[model samples]
Target: MEGRQLQQVLNPQRLKALQEWMQKSSITLTQVNGQRKYGGPPPGWQGPVPGPGCEVFISQIPRDVYEDRLIPLFQSVGIIYEFRLMMNFSGQNRGFAYAKYGDPVTASTAVMTLHHYRLPDGGCLTVRKSTEKRQLRLGDLPTNINQVKLLTLLRMVSDGVEDVMLKMAGPKGREVVALVNYSSHYAASMAKKVLMQAFKKHCGISITVKWTSFSKSKHVSETEQEDGTSTPPGLNPFPKPSISPPHLHPQPFLHNVPAHPPLQSSFSAVGGPAGPPRDEMKPQGPVNCDTVSLLQWMCEVHRLGTPQYEIRYHHASSDGFLCFSYEVLIPCFLIPLYGVIQILPGPSAQATKEEVYRAVAELVIQTICKVSSLRPF
Candidate 1:
């Protein structure tokens, strides 16, 4: 009967409902005086109590595992108050879960019995009493997102974003998602709105979000008679009439980029410096390995790293480094037959006009002349 009651609480529909409620209500994992205005701890709960055996954190949940596997494993020793596996926006496990027992003694017993127990998937569990219960995972972000860009977007939503994680995702295991941990639940709740706006503005797509926090115990007096089946105590398991933040509209991120207009060539169209038409140009000339050798020598002399040279019927491109001592990056493009190579300065590079443009036309022309004389077939 005890095991049967535990299974009822772990039902998929019930868990889904709890997750939805938690997301809609902006439930959090931390205990704070300011959270009362948002919503107090979940239904049938007293408040935060700091002591041993109240709760245990399981840090290594295998991917194949679920509530069914977890509920029975923990309930073997004692009656549990609540159990929750932290989930991301995509409804995938975030590699951790939490369980609180009816009493501190039961919690300790479970910890001792199952701390290092290995799961079927070969993952050993890390269960121990939780002390610092303040963590939340942000999910449903676009794939291949730049971290710096994501951070800038998050800051637009809240000033309390303390950490960020980009983890693997997708059915094919090829996509990436973002996870943000805020200093407080309030900041995290507010983050949801701003992140949504940021996603739409930057990615041009709507995103889903889910909130996951550690479970806490309901007040002992409020849950004395029942079999142990109840919604796990989270930030607020039961919704209450609470004041909402008046404004959740997110402002633009600090590094937000404005739309760019179509690119126009600096060289004009008719009779421009872009040179002769493709049909009018001479046939493919003899290949110039000397120029390639010279380019390689130049790269080596300056310790600019290895350079790649490409040659095609129409033109060629080669990549070469400018500096080797530090991390300064300058992009230098070589245009075939055009005689000039354009070197663009990096963002933080303090290069002067002279440093940006170096005359290598003479060498290029010489190499082309020497190579062109060899053949034209």
Candidate 2:
């Protein structure tokens, strides 16, 4: 089956015929010559062994699949206990992973549903119940990290992290390791991978993050709260408001564009080589080439010596709709234009370019009317 083509392995017509024959013959199609049966044990073998209820084995996973991509795929199936992508010494994926499901029944269901699942990259998955019932590993962190800080970081990475526990290593318990437990195994796996990548890329630190055996002898404690408060033993922490990082966080704006960058780089100034700004054009019900050109030209100019937000018009096209439509793109952020609209006569002998401009502007305004929050790129 490895070297042979699919057609050589099984012909459609013959396989259909064999299926009919088996139904008519009332006999189970157990084995073919030199080959074991599709499932079940061979002759003289004992009954099938039970799989570990919590774990799942996945194979033939695409090499490009990462933590962010993998979590969403399995998370919908059920809460996860662990998701470990096997890596080779060369620091590349080994094309397999073990995901532990919080619910044993859900783990089995995931195997049945996702087995042979087709990926966007054309790779098919092989999902099955794992035989090993091992403890999940802790994500390694830098030394001197406080338990409170560790808990905050893990929570920011994922909402599923349920508890945090720390352990000491080395002489005099000098070295520290934090154990993060998740409500769902999927969250634990995601936190490990995301934190590992974030630390390396943003903080310039290489850290070990993997599954460790769960132990009954270990002492575990609840995470600390925002106000330097600790949760009671065996209880979860209360929700706290999130704080945005100072950098990379942008101020609020109509289009959510980064305002610090010079507007010249993103928007075209009016009357120069760059096109005109949008705000300068007076609300003349209709417009001609001169009016539209003036409107386009007016965008770059500062209104009353004050800088107002500008919208850059690219071009206009019409498709027999009796209306000219235009698309505008802003730098740093993409905004769908929506605002005041002015209805004007359709393109006609008497209608001027200003009328067409107004129609397009109205259309733009209509499209972006509901956008309250702009997402920064």
lDDT against true structure, model 2: 0.41
> What are the per-residue Cα lDDT tens digits for candidate 1 across 267-317?
112212222232332333333433334444443443332332111011112
Candidate 2 displacement at residue 282 in angstroms: 82
lDDT per residue (tens digit) for residues 116-164 in model 2: 8898757998775542411123434567667787677667766566556
Sliding window of 10 residues with minimal summed lDDT for model 1: 324-333
**Winner by lDDT:** 1
Off by over 4 Å in 2: 1-55, 58-128, 131-143, 200-205, 214-377
Q: By TM-score, who's the top model here? A: 2
- The lDDT of each candidate is 0.42, 0.41
Q: What is the TM-score of candidate 2?
A: 0.28
